[model samples]
Target: MAFFNREDIDNFDKIHRINLMNSLSGYKSANLLGSISPEGQENVAVFSSVVHLGSTPPVLGFILRPTTVPRNTYENLKETGFYTINHITQTIAEDAHHTSAKYDKGISEFEMTSLTPEYKNGFLAPFVQESPVQIGMKYLEEYYIKANDTIMVVGEIQFFYVKDEMLQEDGFLNLSKGRVATINGLDGYAIPNLFTRYEYQRPKKIENSI
Candidate 1:
């Protein structure tokens, strides 16, 4: 077994420390956040931090690293108040990951990579056409994380488009059916399978024993 303490992690090389820390949380959702600037310049970037905040209003959130550097997705979404979250799948994993490359502000990642952008129902932002699960999001609010200087941007799901076969009757999404990809670390991409589904659990009644 390997062990790493706070001091040990701090002493490691920059890349080593970053890779180790980013992977400690295990597999994360792989998504492509699509946004368009006010001037209609589209931006698509890969992210692993998108998370469900609530079901009542279908809220979701994703973290943005400290804005010391250029963050086109963050800038576009903030200005336009709209974005799209699209699930990355096995078929487009490579192209999706390529979006992580830092490009000039006006350059469209869609043109650089094999990924294609689709506009649905007159939504302001574009969605990845190859993604199985596509969600149109309206910006809600954001919280500043004092500890790490990151920002958590929250949004409400305005539109959801999922493949017919992937949605279960009870409202569960079977990601395996779509070959959805998950992030193992900063760069590793994997396609997970459906193991087994368990029903809601309740405490078992205890009986008197002789």
Candidate 2:
């Protein structure tokens, strides 16, 4: 057996190692923000900064850049108090990536891409019709992480639409099998190949407790 050392044959430093890992942790779920225009032109901008805050209250969160940047998503979420969360997949990956472009104000990324934006369930927020899963959410509280100049906009889910076949036998979240994509790093997306399905714990007794 051979042991490897990180310091010996390094092409990148420790910082690079950490940055790369954090950037490529996994492909992130891409979401599109929809809001009524100040001048009545509805718009959509794709974002991959979404996070799952909790499961009990079904909290979902997304991060946005500062107000000074004139980000439409930031404006819409603040103005409308609602948005749609769409899961990413291999099929929509290219279009999902295209949404990241810094488009002109009032320009609709939905029209530019192949994604179809549809309104359902009586909410003003729009969602991608082709996604395997889509969730409609209502605005919630926001908190500042402090260390980073970022704000977490948490939302409570009204209802989530999911494909029935994506459910696991034990009712676990089976995103990998759904071929749902994720953002690994800052600008890349990939589909994960799942090889493990069981939850593991440290001690043998932990298994019993679980």
Candidate 3:
């Protein structure tokens, strides 16, 4: 087995260290965050950090790299207070990954890739037409992580659109049925299969030894 301590990881090559650190958390949710500038310029970028922050408020959060460089998605969402989170699917994995490429301001990733921008009910931000699960979000708050200089952006789910068949009766989203993609590392995309899902657990009485 391979072992890496703090010092060893710190001394690794830049690319190697980044890859190891990013993938160490295992498979992450692959999502495309869609936003529109006040001037109506649309931007979409692939992200693997989207996470459910709370159920009561239907809040979700995602991590963003430092703002030292230009981040169109972040800028747009901050200014407009709206964005879309779309689940990446197996069919659009390549195009979804391509959105990660840095582009100049005002350039729409939807135009550069095969993906299509979808607008519904006059929502300012667009959603990926090919995604099986699409969520409209309203910017809520953000926290700065001093340790890594990253930012955690939080939002409240305003609208949710999922394929009917993918939603189970108990309100569980069976992502495997929709063929949603997950990120392994920086560039690896995979479609996970469904393993058995256990029911909610409860503490059981211990059996005394005979």
Candidate 4:
């Protein structure tokens, strides 16, 4: 196996380093974050960093790169205090990926892409109408990661609009059944299926749990 130390990694070409580091962490959830400017211009962007932060409070967090550049999603979220996280499925994965394209300010990605924007229950932000699982969130807080100039934006889950049958009685989401797409690297898209579901394990029973 090829070994890359810190110096070697840092010296690698920018694109090479990005691909290597991004894929090194394995599959990440492919999602589209939808936000709207204060003026009502809708914006949607593909993201792979959405992670569950807490269950009791129903919080989720996503990492946003530095704001040195114009990040419409970040700016819109801060301005509106709301956003939506829509799961990328095989049907809309291509359109979802295109949301990552840098559009001119005030341009709506929904118009540029085939994906449709949907609003529900009077939520201020728009949701991807084609997505099977859509989550409406309220901005909670932002924490800066000093190590990487990125910010972890946390939000509270205010509403969920998932297909009824996809949700299990135990609250587990059968994402595999929905053909949810997972991101490999920056541009790689993959659809994953469920192999098995195992129960939670404790120390002594861990070995034979599955």
Q: Give the Å error, residue 154, model 3.
A: 0.4
lDDT of 3: 0.95
Encode model 1's per-residue lDDT on 96-135: one tens digit a residue: 9999999999799999998999998999999999999999
Model 4: residues with Cα > 4 Å off, grouped in runs: 205-210
Q: How far off is residue 125 in model 2, in Å?
A: 0.9
Highest lDDT scorer = 1
Comparing 3 and 4 on lDDT, the stronger one: 3
Superposition TM-score, candidate 3 onto the true structure: 0.97
Q: Tell me the alpha-carbon RMSD of every candidate.
A: 1.1, 5.3, 1.1, 3.3
- Whole-model alpha-carbon lDDT for candidate 4: 0.93
**Shift of residue 107 alpha carbon in model 2, Å:** 1.0
lDDT of 2 by residue, 84-167 (tens): 788878888888778878888768888789988888888787788888888888888888877767888898988988888787
**Regions of candidate 2 where Cα sits further than 4 Å from its true position:** 1-27, 38-40, 199-210
Residue pairs in candidate 4 whose N, alpha carbon or C atoms collide under 3 angstroms:
none
Q: Which residue pairs show backbone clashes in model 1? A: none
Model 1 alpha-carbon drift over 4 Å, by segment: 208-210
* Candidate 3 lDDT by residue in tens digits, 100-164: 99889868999999999999978999999999999999999999999989999999999889999
State the C-alpha lDDT per candidate. Answer: 0.96, 0.75, 0.95, 0.93
